[model samples]
Target: MSGHLLMGALLTGILAGYGIAIPVGAVGAYLVGLAARERFAVAASAAFGVAVVDGAYALLAVLGGAGLAEPLRPIAVPLGYLSAGALVLLAGLTLLRAVRRYRGPLTVSASSPVRAFLGLLALTAINPATLVYFLALILGRGAEGGGALFVLGALLASASWQLLLVCGGGLLGRALTGARGRLVIAIVSAVLMLVLAVAALTGGSPVG
Candidate 1:
């Protein structure tokens, strides 16, 4: 790829990564919760898990896996609706849990790093929208193999941005350790996730 094209891809990747990562969805909320309950080491592993999934999707997109978009395209509308509904259900559950009387810090089961990694990888892989996003990227860019360097640059940019979000979550978790504080953050984030899920399902105007 030409220097200009590579730079453009890098910038696009950075923007897209931030765009996708910023939304506090199920995974994001879970990450924050994990961080609050565990140390940075655990949180970092979770973050790395997220990054690997994202990078894999980006690579697939750059490799002209636009064909993968077809199967999802036929069902996108229905799936979006279902995703929105699920989000709403999850939000309600979270709210109930937060308000209900409970004791002790939220405890995540102790699992090996590989388990955590696989958990996120599987979660992300099942997300049809992620693959669709990659397909869109491929179509917009014309082919994949032709822009290997640009693709790599974009993937790196995305990975870096996502890793930073994980780090930030770790920091935030440390800062909010009290019971009440954790409760408040969890509730607020759950609400945000609901909003995002609704937006995703409705095909709201693009933010980026």
Candidate 2:
């Protein structure tokens, strides 16, 4: 396969990347919330961090995920459960922190951009279901000579979508500037995360 055939791999990668990310599950919601509450730079870094993880998984899928696919199946669901629990835990913590801040003098509590990036990266990394997803896609398409193209396509695709999310969050942050309003946003964000976690466990999309 060469020429246009290689471009097909890129197209496939783009479609697959969007397919995995478009559902905008727990971690995606968290990213949006983080953006709304914090600086856009921090949120953008976090978005890039998530995209990096997605690209890494895509790379792994194209490289040698086929061998691991069989072994990964048994644990994917269990890890997805753990991922759901993690989302719920994050929701609880988010609501608690928001309440604490709302009661006291308002504080920014802004996370550094680096910390935000690493935080999102680690959170996304724990999602073995994501790995399983890429592996399945690779197995279906049979990534061969176009492995690098696939990775590049996946990386760009996921990054673009995540950045779009950050943009929405940024707009939200601009609109709601009051402490009470921010607190409400946090509560709502927490609720959304909890809801998404339930959906993930109950045969819906996987979440981080």
Estimated TM-score for each candidate: 0.68, 0.89
lDDT for every model? 0.62, 0.82
Where does model 2 exceed 4 Å of error?
Answer: 206-208
> In model 2, where is the ten-residue run with the lowest total lDDT?
199-208
Name the TM-score of candidate 1.
0.68
lDDT of 2: 0.82
Model 2 RMSD in Å is 2.0
Backbone clashes in candidate 1 total 0
**Candidate 2's residue-wise lDDT over 1-208, tens digit each?**
7789789889988988887777878777888888778778888999999899989999988878678788776877777787778788889988887788778886766578898789778778878878888988888876466888888888898898999998888788779877788788888888998897887798665464
Q: Which stretches of candidate 1 lie above 4 Å from their native place?
A: 1-19, 22-26, 85-102, 105-112, 144-148, 204-208
Model 1 per-residue lDDT tens digits across residues 76-176: 67666655665566567656665552364465535456765675555555566666776677687675334455445545655565466567766776787
